[model samples]
Target: MKKIHNYFAIVFLFFALHAVGQTKDNKWTFGMDIAWVSYSEADKIAVGGKFINQTPRFSLAKYMFKNVVFVGSVSTAIGDNQTYTTFDGAARYDFGTSQNKVVPYALIGGSFINARILTPTLNFGAGSTLWFSPKYGLNVQLLYKFSEERFSSQRSHIMPSIGLVYSFGARDMNPRIWSSTR
Candidate 1:
């Protein structure tokens, strides 16, 4: 798992660095999000302890790509004392490439799962971003992770989940860069 994460991080960094150079001006988009996340768990027959599941989640993403953006965020929940960190370095495109005012983009990246019982989760999802501005918008995500936990025989919730994405940032180019253009 660590190996995959390392490789992904390396590749993502390389691509992000290369992509960032393409922008004529320095631009950034950031936002905060909150949502309900549902988790699945099975009980251990011999141990006599039941596992709890939840589906509430919260996250924030920043778009730092000229044509394609690198998204990074932290996700957390109250159930199972579980917390996850995710990095998505995917290409995002607006319908018209115009300054944001409701644009949708696709996401493709790896998610690293960290928890007590589950063997780390590395999954991928494809979603869209509805932008109100270049710096802010409503993000919708549909994600699926390959389950890798050994538990009791009983069946439980097992499927993909949907997430709400929010971005926040300034619409105007940074003043520092504007001076250089002149």
Candidate 2:
């Protein structure tokens, strides 16, 4: 209960501070996604598995340098007797290849996941954003997470997410960065 309150308060603060700190040259993106998480601990006999679940994921990304974007994402599920959550901080790089309105990017990062206990994991993923307009886009991502058995009981898992994105301070589909020449 208290944790959920803290999360909302932090999110509100983030938006207020971000709005005040925005500039014409800086690009910031906010994404909301419905993520499907597949746990590898599912029964070995079942072909489709039973550990897949859906949750909402929220992300805030800042365009830094030319190809690098720093991202922070959070997802939480509070059940009657359990709490599951994960926080990921990743650096996403945009490839030079972009076709029409589709732009692809790859990211690598670290994550802290709490299933029954808090544990650290290494994460890598690839995703793409399909822009319908200058300010709106559809975002999709897949993540590969790895953890050691010595540190945690849960093994590696894969998460796939699809959602909508809003980009602030963008020129066409690209973000403009402040430079000396400009």
TM-scores of the candidates are: 0.47, 0.73
| lDDT for residue 106 in candidate 2, whole number 0-100 | 93
Which lDDT tens digits does candidate 1 get at residues 1-182? Answer: 45744664565445434431112243443333443334443323322233323333333344454556665554444434434333323344443332434344555554444443333344455555544333334556655444444532222222233433323323442233213231
Number of the top candidate by TM-score?
A: 2
Tens digit of per-residue lDDT, candidate 2, span 1-182: 66865775577556534541112354587877777667754521222343444455788988777678889999886432335578999998876433236667899999998876788989999998877766567889999888776764456778899987766654443333211122
When summed lDDT is taken over every stretch of 10 residues in candidate 2, the lowest stretch is 173-182
TM-score quality measure for candidate 2: 0.73
> Runs in model 2 with CA error above 4 Å?
1-26, 41-54, 78-82, 97-100, 174-182
Task: Assess each prediction's global lDDT (C-alpha) against the native.
Answer: 0.40, 0.68
- Model 1 is weakest, by summed lDDT over 10 consecutive residues, at 152-161
Off by over 4 Å in 1: 1-26, 38-66, 79-98, 117-122, 133-135, 147-182
